[model samples]
Target: ILILFFVMMAQMVVLTLPRAAACLNRAQQVLEIEPSIVDGERTLDDGAREPQDEADAVAVFDHMSFRFDDADEDTLCDLSFACRRGQTTAIVGSTGSGKSTVAKLLLRFHDATKGSIRLNGVDLRELTQDEIRGRIAYVPQKAWLFSGTVASNLRFGNEGATEGDMLHALEVAQSTFVLDQPQGLDTPVAQGGTNFSGGQRQRLAIARALMKHADLYIFDDSFSALDFKTDAALRHALQGETRDAAVLIIAQRISTILHADQIVVLKDGEVVGLGTHGELMETCEVYRAIAESQMKGGE
Candidate 1:
C-alpha cells in the first residue's frame, strides 16, 4: 500500500512539470524581448553641456518622419521646425494629425524612421535616453500622482526642493487650492490623485514638472482642464518661469496657442502652416479655417 501511494504522488508531480516548463518559457520570452530603442553610447563633454549661443535653437527637427511598424503610412511626414530658448513654439491640429507625436519624438519615446531630431545641434540618436530627457520637463495629457502627501509628490520633481520652491511652483501653476487644505503641502494625496478634481490634479502635476530645472518645457494639452481665466493667468505667470527655457505647447484649443511665437499647423501628419496667428490667417488656409471654426464655436 505504501509503495502504491508513493507512485501516485510521483505521477502527480510529473504531470505538473510540463505546465511549469511552459510558464518558464513564456517568462523567458518576455525577458528576452529587446527594447524598441537602444541607448546610445556617446557622452556629452563639459563644453557640450551648455549652449554656447543663447540665440541658437534648443531643438531642431530636420524633415523628420515616423511610422509605426504595422502602419503603412507615416504618422509624421517630413516635419521640420526649430524651438529656440526663451520662445514659445505651439503645435496645433485636428485629431489624428500627429500633434503629440512631436513631443514623444523629442522625449525619445520613439525614434524617427526618416530624418533626424537634434538638441543643441547634437543629433538625438547620438545621445543616451537619460541625457536627452534630463534637459526636458514634460507634462503629459493625463496628470497622475502617487499615493503620498502633496509635498512628497512635489519632491518627486526635485528631491532637494525647499518649501519655498514648492510654494513658488504651486503659485505659478495656479494651484493655490493646496493652501486651503487642512495640512496644506502635507495634505494626503490618493493614488493617481483620485481625491482631487481633474483641474486640481493638472495643476499639481504642472507644479511638479516646474520644480525640475530643464532647458525645455513641454506642456502636452495640460491646460485643457483649467478654466479660461486660470489658463490665461497660468500662461502669463509661466512667461516668467520659462523665460530662460524653451517652451513647447501642444494644444487643440486655438485660444491656448494664439499668442505662440510660432504656430505649427499639422494636417494629416504634414505641416500645412508655420507662422504666427496673424501670419497663418493670411497665408495658410488650413490654419485660417481652424481659427475661424474655433471662433464660431466661441472657444
Candidate 2:
C-alpha cells in the first residue's frame, strides 16, 4: 500500500514539472523584456496650462502619425482633431483603418512617430503616463471584469466611491440589471465576467469607468454588444453624466455614432472625412459608401 502511494505521488510530480518549468520560463522572458514606453520626468501639476482660451476643447491631436517599430509604413497618418468638453467625437471606419490605434496613442501605449498630441495645452510626451491615464476614463474594446463582487469591481475606478455614487454610475451605464441580481452589488463576478452575457459585461465595464470623474471619457467599441434602443438610451444617459468632460467613441456601426457632434472617417490610416454624419454623407464618397452598405445590410 505504501509503495503504491509513493508511485502515485511520483506520477503527479512528473505531470506537474513540465507546466511549472514552462511558467517559470515565460515569467523570466517577460522580466527580461525592456519596456518601450518610459515615464516622463514631469507630472500633471508641473507646467500645466489652464486652457483658458480653448476651455471646451481639452485634448488636441495635431497632425499626429504613428508607425510600428517592425511595420513597413505608418499605421496612422496626419490625424488631427479636438475632443471638446460637453461634446462627443466619434471615429468610424472599416477594420484596420487605425481607429483603435488613435485610442492607443492617446493612452500612451506607443509614442507618435510624428506630430504631437496634447492634453490641456500640455504635450502628452511631457506628462507622466500615470498622470495622463489618471485624467482619462477608458472602456477598452474588450470589457474585462475581475473576479469579485460587482461593487468591488466598480470601486476599481474610484476607490472612494460611495454606494450611491456607484448606483448612479450603474444607472448612467444602463447597468440597472445589477440591481435585479440576488445580492445586487455583492453578486459574485466570475473571472473575465464569463458568467454574464457580453452585453452585461460591457455595461458593467461602462459603469466602472463612469465611477471615475475624469476629464476625458473614452469608449472603444463599447456599445457594439447592445441593441439599438439600449445603445441610444445609454448614450443619452452618458451625455448628461459626462456633460463636463470630453467623450471619444470608436465605433464600427453607423447608427452608434450617427448623432455625434463630430464624425471622423478614416481610410488606409488616413483621415478621409472630418465632419458631422450628414455632412460626411454629402461630401465623402468613402463615408457615403460605408453608410450605404450598412444601411442596405440592415434592410
Candidate 3:
C-alpha cells in the first residue's frame, strides 16, 4: 500500500503530461478509502451529503495509467477522476496533454495499465465493452458521420431514434438550417461528413450525441471547430435539454468550461488543478496562468 501511494502520488498535476485536452494516468492500484468524515463545519441546517458508498457514484477511476502499444514512457501516469449524473466535468489543457485519452478510457477503447475503472461499481475490464459503452455517447475531436443524411447521422446514435428524435436533436443543435437546404434530411453527406463546414459538422455531432441521451456524454475537443456564437448557443441548449445527464467536455477553450461543475486542469499528463473555476484561480498557480493565458483575463 505504501509503495502504491508513493508511485501514484509522485507526479505533478502540472507539467510532464500529454498536450491533449484530457488524459487518465496509468494507475497500477488505486487507493480505497472507507467512508469517514474527518472534518466538517457545524451548520444550523444539515447540508445534503454525498452517498458514502463508492458504488453510488456514476463512475470512478481508481489509480489508472496508460501508454501506447510501443511507447517506452507512459502517456498517462497515476490518474484518477470521477463523474456523476447531472454534473458537467471539463478537462482542459494544451496539446499532448492526453485530453482525448480520458474519453478513450471511458469508452473502454484502451485498458488501464494498473488501476481499475468502474461504472456503477463494476470493474470496466470485467464489463463487456458493448455493455459499458451502451450508456455513453461519444463525440470525438473529429466529427465522424456516416455516408448519409443529417437524419441518418442523428439516428445512428440510437437505432430506435424516430423522426421526432432527429428533429429534437437538430433543434437543440440549432441546425434548423437543414430545413432551408435543398433536400433536408435526404441531402447526401459525404463520408466522415467532409462536405459540411467545421461548425456545422460539430453541431451535427452534438445533435447525434444528444439523441442518445445516454447516461454519459463525452466530448473531446468537440467544440474547438465552432464559432463563439454557435458554441454559446449549443451550450445553452445542452444545459437545458440534458439537465439530468452527466457531461464530460474536453476542450482547449477556457470559456467553454467556466460554468462546468468541475474543471480539471492537466499539464504534462498530470492533474495540476481540480476544482470549480474560481477555486482553481485562487489556489492553483499553474491553473491560473493557463486560465489567464487562454482566457486573456486577469490572473
Candidate 4:
C-alpha cells in the first residue's frame, strides 16, 4: 500500500508541474503587457459636446490602419467609410478580411495605428472608453449569458429596465418563447446559457442590447445561429425598433446584408467595393463572386 501511494504521488507531481509552469508563464506575460488603448480623462457627462445631427452620430473611418503587436504587416490598411445614422451598413468579407477589426476599432478595443476614427464628429481617442461605448449597443459573435434569471440578464443593459421593457425587447428579438416558460422572466439560466439553444441565447443577447436604447447598434454576426425564417423576422422587427439609430452589421451571408443601405466588401484586409448590393454586383468582382457562391450553394 505504501509503495502504491508513493507511485501515485510521484505521477501527480510529474503531471501538474509542467501545467503549472505554463500557466505561470502565461500569467506573467499578461501582467507584463500593457494595453495600448487607454481611457481619456474627459467624459460625456462633463460638458462634452453632443452630436449635432443625424450625420454627427455617424462613425467615420478616415484612412484608418491597424497592425497587431508582433505582427509583420497591417491587419487593416487605408480603410475609409461612413456608417450613417438611421441606416444599416454591412461589412461583408471572407475570413481574416478584418471585418471584425473595424467593429473593434469603433468600440476602441484597439487604437488605429494610422489615421483616425470619429464618432459623432468627435475623435474616438478624445473620449473616455466608457463614454464612447455608452452610446453603442454591441452583440458579439458569441452570445454569452451568466448564471441568473432571464430578468437579471436583461437588466445588465439597463439596471432600471422594467418587466414591460424586457418583454418588448424580447418581442423585437423574436424570442417570444420565453413568455411560455412557467417562471417567465424568472427562469434560471445555466452558466453560458447552457439551458438554451444557440439561437435562443442569441435572441436573449439581442434583447439585452435592445434594452439599452443606445444611439448605435453593432451586430457582430449576431444572426448567424438563427434559421432563415427567424433571421428575417428578427431583421424586420429590428427595422422598426432601431429606426432612429445607426446600425453596423458584420455578416458572412449575402442574404443577411442584401437590404442594407450600403455594403462594404473586404478582401485581404482591404476594401474592394463600396456600394449597394446591386451596384456591387455590377462593379465589384469580389462582391459578385461571393454572391454567386452563396447562390450556388443555396441551389
Which is the leading candidate under lDDT? Answer: 2
Answer with 1 or 3, whichever has the higher TM-score.
Answer: 1
Model 2 spans > 4 angstroms off: 1-32, 50-53, 296-299
lDDT winner between 1 and 2, please give it.
Answer: 2
Between candidates 2 and 4, the TM-score winner: 2
TM-score of each: 0.91, 0.88, 0.79, 0.87
Predicted candidate 1, C-alpha RMSD:
2.5
User: lDDT per residue, candidate 1, 159-185, as tens digits?
Assistant: 999999999999999998999989999
Tens digit per residue, CA lDDT, model 3, 26-87: 23123354322121232212342334675335677777888777889878777788887778
Clashing pairs for model 1 are none
Query: Positional deviation of 194 in candidate 1, in angstroms?
Result: 0.3
lDDT of 3: 0.79
Q: Best-fitting candidate, measured by TM-score?
A: 1
The alpha-carbon deviation from the true structure for residue 30 of candidate 1, after best TM-score superposition, in angstroms, is: 1.5
Tens-place lDDT per residue, model 2, 187-217, is 9999999999999999999999999999999
| Candidate 2 local Cα displacement, residue 229, angstroms | 0.9
For each candidate in the order shown, give its overall lDDT on alpha carbons: 0.92, 0.92, 0.79, 0.91
Worst 10 residues of 3 by lDDT: 36-45
Model 4 residue runs over 4 Å out of place are: 1-33, 45-54, 296-299
Please give, for residues 30-50, the per-residue lDDT of candidate 4 as tens digits: 999977887877765566564
